[model samples]
Target: MLLKDHVVLITGAGSGLGLGVAQYCKAQGAAVIVTDIATDKIQSLASEFDEQDLLLSCDVTKIADLERCKDAIVQKYARLDAVIGAQGVFDGNLPIQGMSTQHLDQLFDELFNINVKGYLLTAHIFADLLKQSQGALVLTTSTAAYAADGGGAVYTATKGAIRSLIQQLAFEFAPEIRVNGVAPAAIGNSQLKGPKALNLDHQKQSDIPKDAFLNLFQSISLLQELPNAEDYGALYAFLASKQNKVMTGQTLVADQGLLNRAVLTQSH
Candidate 1:
């Protein structure tokens, strides 16, 4: 009952971490609205939840599309309690020199638009409602914010920017709304792996020389085991709950011990 009677909206809820959070929120008694661009997947996931009334198909990169989603949810629930921004894309691994300028430019542009601008749009549209409810905004950032080669250069930049955005927005939105973020370590269940997701199979064939990406994590992470997408849900739930009142403008790193190992290595 951490989110009892609350109305929570989560973007990128079709699959991966977003869907995991949506399910967790629903189980906690929140009236949850799950949204993603993939209509069929959203519908499929919604069927499992038994509450499609709160499901929406949204493309967070587009302000107007997201507005439509917000409007629909408001019409049904009349109030907004919390929002979790988790929609993002990663084109696996390609060295900076191997990556095409066109690919890099387009990917970074879209990445920032979705990862950063999407948060801005959601905050703007939902700020008033969240202010009224004294709700929280939980954004998803990655451990790439701290490590250069954790992901692609562009991917790293986008996550790092999101971390900074969370801090600034927390200050600007002040006592009315609470904003926080989670910076996870290499998550095992990624959309970046499959054909329908980041489509890494074809990507590896095209630009990247390696057969598989994400090998760098093994060497750097002391824990050796990568976290699953579902493993991150509890952190978001905690940040979204009233239990986290005094913790705003902050970030939690769920890296399974990679960061500490990195720090120790640097000191040595």
Candidate 2:
């Protein structure tokens, strides 16, 4: 009941981590608004939500789509308490040396547009609604932003940009709206698609063998247990709720101690 009586919006709720967070938000009693670029993915989520929730097709990079969603939220709930941006793309972890100059340019815009700009646009569009309610805004980053080799160069750069965006946004929106970010590592059941620039859009991270992923995670992670997307919901819920007053302008590293362990192992 952390979000009881609250109205929350979640972007990129089609599948994987975003989908899990949306469900958890609903269970916490928030009138959740779920949106995704994939209409079919959102349609499948309809039954899981009651009338108290809304489902929409949205591309976070598009202002018109977001404006439409805002109108819908106003028509239904009248106010927005929080906005959680979970939309992103992975860069397939291809090394810089492996990529051509042409591929790099294409990937740069593609990943930045979706990974970084999407959050930026959504935050800007929804800022008024959040300020009106004195609510929160939570954007997703990644551990790649903090340490090397967390992802390929382009993907890591995009995530790093988000980390900075959170701080700047919190400063600008202060005394009215709180802004923060979460940087997760090794999320389980992530269907996180790769970049279309690299012709990897048709593939998903989850296509990797479960055992292989788990084994790799265990070797480098101190927790040694891969957390399901829902396991991260409690943190998101709190950050996206009125109960959070002490935290703002920060990105919580929800890496299951992977980075901590990585630093130690690499030091040896």
Against the correct fold, how does model 1 do in TM-score?
A: 0.86
Error of 2 at 268 (Å): 12
Please list the Cα RMSD from the true structure of every candidate, rounded to 1 decimal place.
4.1, 1.5
lDDT (C-alpha, whole model) for all candidates: 0.77, 0.92
Q: How accurate is candidate 1 locally (lDDT)?
A: 0.77
Residues 109-227, model 1: lDDT tens digits: 76677778888888888899899888899999988898666677777888999999999999988898889999987665565431222335333222332224245556666665556
Candidate 1 Cα misplacement greater than 4 A, ranges: 193-219, 262-268
Clashing pairs in 1: none
Range of the 10 consecutive residues with the lowest summed lDDT in candidate 2: 259-268
Rate residue 59 of model 2 by lDDT: 91
The top-ranked prediction according to TM-score is: 2
